[model samples]
Target chain A: MEKIKSIIEVKNLNKSFGSNHVLRDFSMEVVPGESLVILGKSGSGKSVLIKCIINLIVPDSGEIYVLGQNIRELDQDQMDKLRAEVGFLFQSNALYDSMTVRQNLEFPLRRHWTKEMRDLNAQSAVKEALEDVGLGHTIDMMPAELSGGMRKRIALARTLILKPKVILYDEPTTGLDPITAREISELMLQVQEKYKASSIIISHDMNCIRMTSDRVIMLIDGRNYISDTYENLQNVPDPKVREFFD
Target chain B: MIHLIKIDSEFLREVGEIARFTGRFFSEVIKPKQEWEEFINQCFWIGFKTLTLVGITAFIMGLVMTIQSRPTLLEFGAVSMLPAMVSVSLVREIAPVITALICAGKIGSGIGAELGSMRVTEQIDAMEVSGTNPFKYLVVSRVLASTLMVPLLSSLAIAISLYGGYLGVNIRGNVSWHLYWLQSFGALGYGDFIPSLIKTFFFGFAIGIVGCYKGYNSKKGTEGVGRSATSAVIVASLVVFIIDLIAVQVTDLLGLT
Candidate 1:
């Protein structure tokens, strides 16, 4: 039997802002087709850890490997090329407020797809991605016009349009109502099932974690404290870990 | 004394950062895959949007200069030289500076607020994560548009100001439209028009750079956006005056005065 290789790896990551240490020698991995949730209290450096993986925030000293390439070694153009294969869903949903839904979906395609390729299949691609998120009717609406949940779906559709090998979700359900949050969680599962793309979801929503996570990593005190299946972690006797379950 | 030194060092640091920002703009501007469509869109907004304000202010300036200077010229029995005097002043100094200052207020604050909010909202980060160069797409396009448009706006303002001068002349005395324009053009040489027009490009660049710098580095969310917009206007307006003063001195040194 062959061992599965990790698709994303972070080793000895450390980051600081002024005197505040956010992430300290933290590390984690996501294997192919895995939904790994980073569960932590607010301001426990979960967001910082994921951002370091994507190189949004430069870690003080660490190695981040994504799809067999060391990201820090890549130049701007090379990093851009690598970025096309990794989709990031911002916590704010970060849709271009000035652009309509169709244009927002097409923004990433502008960089990754050739004009001829886009002309040939861009419409259908946009349509299919929107349909995957059940937002086919919002093809022309401005982001400001959409409800919060609809905006989140549109943002997810934009992420899915690239058919990336990995997706990073930053607090996907932070501001949504419980129903909407569950819907987004379900959408995340559907996206994973449909695309088979591995994901690192940063969330404290236990329901979302239970529904979407194959495994959960407890990020505590700027480090990866523990990793286990959600149910197994719920039964752990460690008080710090039990604090989360309780 | 230590506190004073810290303040001085902080100011110098800001200056150095702005110089670095300007250097990045130059470096990125010449790279291939230029965002021409966005540049044109910015040109329309930065140029066409500010035309009305610039034109109105210029017309008022020319009219006021003509009406007030009438008494001075009449004392010297040179009231006939009113058109030439007004044209030279407008072409050499007034129109470009005033138009640029107006843009510093309107367009500068606008770009600052727009980019600042986008920064706060993480749109810029999203652009970068999407494999797009946000600086090249946003900063270069806006800077280039303002650099090109300010001079064009000044040129338009000069023409409008001259027309207002003509109207002012006719309000109290008789000067034919043809003669008013003829006298206005006759007093102007390459030296007056070219130097003033050249200065406006710097004015535009300063405004664009300052606006972009403040916005791109904004923090603390909405309050930061407001601060960026306010400071962009203040710094851009000051830079316009400084650039104008330098242009005047340089032109004088070159004997273009």
Candidate 2:
């Protein structure tokens, strides 16, 4: 039997801001179609780790390979081309406040899709993505008009419109109430099942972690302290790991 | 002494950052794949939106100048030169500077606040992650729009101001509309009009660039947005005056004064 290859590979990544180091010689990988969670407290560098993978924050030193290409070696145009294959859902949703829902969904298509492609299929694509997120009726509303949960769903819809091979989620349920949080978690599962897209979710919400994670990586003190299933992590005797389950 | 040195260095660092930001604008502006749609949108907002404020201020300026200058000219027995005096002053100096100052308050603060809020919300980061060049789309379009629009606004202000001067003359004297316009145009030469018009482009560029630079670099969230907007107006207004002073000197050197 052939072994499965990793979709994303980070090796000895290090990052620092002035005298404060955030990620230190940390490394991880995401296999195809896996939902891998980076679990840590706020300010524990989980967000920094994922941002480094997408090249949003340049690592001070190390290598990041996405889809088998070394990101540091790519030029701006090349990086942009690579970015089309990766979707990032920001914590704040980052929806363009100036645009309506349809326009917001179409914003990414403006650059990645050709005029002919858009003229032929853009409307259907927008509708399909919105339907996937259960937000088909919000096609004309402004982002400010949507409830918090709906805004998150619209943001996820925008991410799905590209049909990316990988999705990087930065705290998908941080501000939502528990009910809405679970809904978003279930939505994450549906996306994975429907699209078969691998994801790196940076989150600490145990409910979200347990529901969405195939495996969890414990990010502690700027390093990957352990990697295991959420159930396995719950049993780990290490006090550092036990603190979370306790 | 150490505290003074630190302050000086901090000031120098800010100047260097702004210079670097201005240089990046030139590099991105000349690149292909210009954002013409956003540019047109910005022109509509930066130009058309501020027309009322600039027009009203210019009319008042011309009317007040004409009315005030009457007594002085009467004492010199040169009250008949009112139209020429008012038109020359409006076309050569008052209209452009006042219009630019107004824009520095309105357009400059507006751009700063909008971009600063966007930055705080991570909308800029989202644009970059979507494979779009945010600088090219946002900064270049706004800067170019302001640079083009300020001169157009100033030209409009000059015309409206001359009309106000005509009205003022009619109030206290009997100069006909035709004769008033004739005297106004007769007093102006290429030197006065061209130099004044040329200076407004620099004024616009300064306002746009300063606003963009502050907003793009704003941090610490909402409070930082307020600071960016306030500083954009303050710095752009000062730069407008500085540019005006330099334009006058250059015009004098060219024997156009």
Which pairs clash inside model 1?
none
lDDT of 2 by residue, A19-58 (tens): 8888989999999999999999899998888888888899
| Superposed Cα deviation of residue B23, candidate 2 (Å) | 0.8
TM-score, every prediction: 0.97, 0.98
Residue A37 miss distance in model 1 (angstroms) = 0.4
Best by lDDT: 2
Against the native chain B, each candidate's TM-score is 0.97, 0.97
Q: For each candidate, what's the DockQ?
A: 0.87, 0.82
Model 1's i-RMS, to one decimal, reads: 0.6
Off by over 4 Å in 1: A1-4, B1-3
Docking class of 2: high
Worst 10 residues of 1 chain A by lDDT: A1-10
The DockQ leader among the candidates is 1
Q: Which stretches of candidate 2 lie over 4 Å from their true place?
A: A1-4
